[model samples]
Target: MSQFKVAAVQAAPSFLDVAAGITRAVAFIEEAAQKGAKLVVFPETWLPGYPNHIWLGPVAWQMQFVGRYFENSIEAGDVHDKAIAKAARDNSIQVSLGLSERAGGSLYIAQWHYDETGELIKRRRKLKPTHVERTVFGEGDGSDLVVKDTAIGRIGQLSCWEHLQPLSKYAMYAQDEQIHCAAWPNLKLYEGGAYALGHQVNNAASMLYAVEGGCFVIAACALVSKEQQDILCEGDPQKEALCPVGGGYTRIYAPDGQSIGADLADTEEGLVMADIDLSMIAYAKAAADPAGHYSRPDVTRLMLNSKPQRPVMAFDETAGLAMEAAEGAAAEADVVEIASAAE
Candidate 1:
């Protein structure tokens, strides 16, 4: 639809409990649907939670949470995944969900999009996991950068710092994305020291994205509960100082770069709902469409390699096998001809 209501989720996950996370996610989905939201966007790694501990302690010391986090990460198309999709279908709401995607022995930051009918329309991973996130997550390829058109509109998504990528943002804008899910983990963890990672900076990034891309931006951020603080800090003053609680800075913005949703307390858990009209993008883009008439493509352009980067590829043996079979048939024919000549 051209105009509709949407929700941005700003709640902490169940923290290393996939089952509990799924249950909570389903409840939120149902609740959003009841509230007349056609779509709901979740924060980054909402399932199994973001590993803020990686930034808190040394890798060796933080190994305690690694195993549990890996085990709790959700797999695409798994039963846990189907449950979330089912919830969307039952409620007839579109969902843009963020989580850690597990494949074989590795995990990648992922966002899955489900249409109102519950069909998975797209699943994208972060092209590059940021900072210490590399310790636990693998990188996604250009193929992961995609924008899909559905009954609602063209939906695209990026997790956390992916929005910070200038080229990545341009690529999505080029595809004419109408609605964007800018998923983020808590921003206030190290606010005392890391000013760049605070709500002011990250929230500005989301607002700039709406203005730049001429698309509605759903900036969903996660909160840090006391339970999460205790687990990571372990009653240590230093650790507590680094990654403190309360970072939920959830918001939604219009194509004109204005806040469209009401505010929520930094520590509070809830959804930020906003009504968006795609028609607004037309005027916004009319003045300056970076990827369109306003751009100087003759001077610069992006080289997007949207191909799946696989580690291994098996070669085809069919040609060699066919040659061998043909040789054997020829040999048999010669022998039969010789026997006939001898007779």
Candidate 2:
């Protein structure tokens, strides 16, 4: 479709509770459909919440929350995953969900995209976990960089700082991605400590992605609720300052790098809606399409290995054993032949 309405969610997670988070996410999906939205995007790790505690203290101090976070994370195709997909199907709306994916006992920041029919079209993880995030999450690889062709448009997803990746952005642009879901965690982190983690810089990153890719950017950011703040801060005034209350800065940008989505109070939670016209990308691309007309292949090129980096490979044991036996038989025959020739 050339034109349609989309929603960028700006809210806190159910805070480390997968069941509650699934229910809340389904409600949001239904609400978006009711609002006449074709698609809805969610914030980073909205299911079971972001690991705010990782930023609060060192490794030993963070030990308390690690187990709980892992326990709450959802595995792909698990009950929680199916619940979100069912919601999309029931509502007849597309969904792009940010979540903490638990696969083989390791958690990775992931985004799940479901088509209107409730089939999972794409699932991507952050190629690299940012700073303290590495403490709790595993890293994704090149295979995670994906842009899918949906009935609505070419949609792609990236989480948090993945927006800051120049080459990664180019990869999506090359795929002719039309709607980019930029999932982000609550920007209200380290209140006074890091400017990079704050609102302005991250929003700029999303805008840049829109401009460079000539695609719609739905930047969804999670918030730090009162309950989350209490858990992370633990009543320490110093901790509170770092993990202070509101950290939501959700926004949507046009292909021309304009902020088209409406605003809410940084502390308030709601969906930031925008009407996206895919054809507008042509206008923006005419000005500059980094991966297309504005190219310099001889001067610079990106080497993208879009393969899943797996830790293990399984082969058929029977086949392997048969091959070994065949080789042993061949060796025995060769030895007997040599002995006969000597005789």
Clashes of 2: 0
- lDDT of each candidate versus the true structure: 0.89, 0.87
- Find the 10 residues in a row with the least total lDDT in model 2: 334-343
TM-score, prediction 2: 0.92
The residue ranges of model 1 lying beyond 4 angstroms of the native Cα positions read 319-343
User: For residues 121-199, what per-residue lDDT tens digits would candidate 1 score against the true structure?
Assistant: 9889999999889999999987777889989899899999998999888888888899999999999878778899999
For candidate 2, write residues 1-343 as lDDT tens digits: 6888999888988887889999999989998999989999999999899888887887898899888888999998789988998999999999999999999979899999999999999888899999878877888887788798899989999999988888888777888889999999999787667898999999999999999889999999989988988888889998889888889999999988899989878899988998989999989988987776687665666667675666774558878887768756754543311011112
Question: Could you list the CA RMSD of all candidates, in the order they appear?
Answer: 11.8, 10.3
Give the TM-score comparing model 1 with the true structure, all chains together: 0.92
